[model samples]
Target: MINYISDHLKNNPLLVLDGAMATELEKHDIDTDSELWSAIALINNPEAIKEVHESYFKAGAKVATTNTYQANVEKFQQFGLNEAEAKKLIIKAVQLAQAAKAEFKADDLLVAGSIGPYGAYLADGSEYRGDYDLTITEFMDFHRQRMQLLNQANVDLFAFETQPNFEETKALAKLLKTEFPQKTAWMSFSIKDSQTLCDGTPLNEAVKYFNDDQQIAAIGVNCTKLENIEDTIVNIKKVTNKPIVVYPNNGDIYDPKTKTWQANPKTSSFKELVPKWIDAGASLIGGCCRTTPADIKEIAEFT
Candidate 1:
């Protein structure tokens, strides 16, 4: 199936929908500092992760991301695991997602192994700084271990998502081409206000950097407000004709006062937003933080 998807992408690229973050999955446990962290809370509770997958499957998601975005060395270090232990945890995360995918007989569903940035922020705390703290070689070495596990799991694709800086993205592109070249890699940037990536680099420059790497199957934005998605995609199209993907965070900026995401996502209802994304040339659409199966269902209905 992975081979089939790879061929399909090589020929006729199609709209790819990513799975929503499992915020609800975090409800199963309250261990904020565990190696598993809030994201991997679903690992111990298999049924919870399975349920989330099933919801997205039913909602019409063609691609489901494994719940492993934060299972990397840096994130685990927040909980005290060394690099080796963190790598193993990443492998375990892939296994758990595979099991969930199997239970649903989601043979046709694409399971993208979620690979996020190496560190929470690019070295300079601005756009990805490849040279800020380490060279491209160092970034390659760091990702090599996890990419190996994702490849072995036979996941449908590799998503190098939520990057804020360009330098880190450059390193990621180089690493993907050299290591997991067989897997289709989708890169999405997280943006701030009218300016650039989360790290302040212009989005256009970021796109151009990724464009040089043929390993990137698709590119676009995620983890931002819906209001910003339209402009983000429009700017992206100017740089490249490759397929675009957008999965905005639900409209509400979290209100720490209430500890909840703002209830009304202003961009549009989930149903309305799908068409907007498609109209804006988004070949892929899904939800990011604060989104749920309901939102995905709306997207699936359109695609």
Candidate 2:
């Protein structure tokens, strides 16, 4: 699978797939907030999780991330659990992916452990960056446990996505380089503008931070509009030659009628912008919120 992802990156430049979506699963009648949603949900019903994986696999995904992004210690603490519970959750999510890979004979499906930010995202730009008891040391300790579980799961890669803050993202990178030295790690910084991460660091500066790390396989953007991805990749290209990946949100993120978070409409239609992303040097591509298997199918067939 590693070779497959590596080879695809060599040829296509944009190996696209669907982005990680929790609420979308909930809309499909799965529990988006299940205790297992972070980990156990996949373990409890590998078949159910397999269904999602197969959907994307058939949709032409080169990578399938285990639904472990929210399975972090801090998030489990919100559910009144401790670090041990969080570790178990992460293990379960990994196990479920392992099962699905074998069942579908998806030898080429790269299983990436989805690692989201430790803080909440506010639409108005007010994230939970508290000046309180939990110092960066404490927070990095929490991330270390998650990384351990992902390493133990033997995932092909670690994907730190939706990381709004540069401080937190840098902290995770430091931990991976020191603790999980054997595993490949990638990063996707969410954007507030075409050129800057949500915390306002320019993409070029962010690229400089990860450029020297050999463990980083690919680095790019996720959870932004497709229309903005070409510009982001082009900007990132100015800094490093690392393989670039993008998982853009399906257009129309905010919907008043349904109050949907990632409204799954085919905003900008896949055919139009996918080639643009490829031409701009994107090495990996996929959908985020509101993206479905069909959208992935469109990308695979068209791209």
Candidate 3:
């Protein structure tokens, strides 16, 4: 019921979001190479997940995105977990973040329940491609269960992140607007470039689609290239007065064939980029893949 993000923004210049979950988990020695990605840690290394959350909080992040990006009942069942067991793991991801908040004793901390796109469950890099097709009902059916679970878990808010498919984004907005009216979310896309979503929807059109929806707390981009953010933020700000939330990858190039992220020395650090994003009107900022708590600390310092 509390708008943790907007409330923070009212008193503070910007809200600081936590960095990567799966990659951050690796630093604690948790294997995240599985199809489940960071969600695997919920079942295998929950303690480490909690530690990562605490690390982000200690590093100055006011928001912790739960380790549920790839966690869904169907995906967990593939590992032989029953429906109830799978659901428990989903909730456990939330509990670990809450436990971390409690351990840190931060009254202002917020836990955002992460809901990745359907492609995330495919684990086929389809999320970046946005080439999947599903009817509205089918899309809602696939996402509803997890949203319901997260809602029941009482997360501070939902983070509909890295969403690519426009139809899927429409479906999620409809689901939230119709069913979870009391809940608030920030919908961030996986953009293809400065002017288009991964699915090829024009950035202005897609951003304008949800511009009037109060249930959507903010709208912008995430899990994208850092170089892609400033222009993308400028584009979104043009169509919507809603706050813009952006957390880009570490400016490393990802290779689909090798599924590895390569560091590019040409990439500018967050210190150089954060000021531009802030100037461009980004209200909440953080890091995505390959970015660590230090990046978040840099963002916090500059903000």
> What are the per-residue Cα lDDT tens digits for candidate 1 across 52-100?
7766776777777877766566666565667777666666666766666
Off by over 4 Å in 2: 1-8, 11-13, 33-46, 77-86, 120-136, 255-259, 262-266
lDDT of 2 by residue, 1-303 (tens): 243456666656467655455644654466554433424354344456666776777777777888876567656666677767766767777776767667667545678888776653112222222112345565578578777888888888888887767777778888877777777777888777678877777878988899887777788887777788988889999999888888887786654244346545556876678888888888678888767887788778754
Q: Which scores greater on TM-score, model 2 or model 3?
A: 3
Per-model TM-score versus the true fold: 0.83, 0.84, 0.98
Model 3 misplaced regions, further than 4 Å: none
Sorted on TM-score, highest at the top, how do the candidates line up? 3, 2, 1
Give the per-residue lDDT digits (tens) of candidate 3, residues 17-125. 9999888888878888888988888888899999999989999999999999999999999988999999999888898899999987868899999989999999999
- How displaced is residue 268 in candidate 3, in Å? 1.0
lDDT of 3 at 168: 95
Candidate 2, residue 237: how far the Cα is off, in Å: 0.9
Worst 10 residues of 3 by lDDT: 1-10
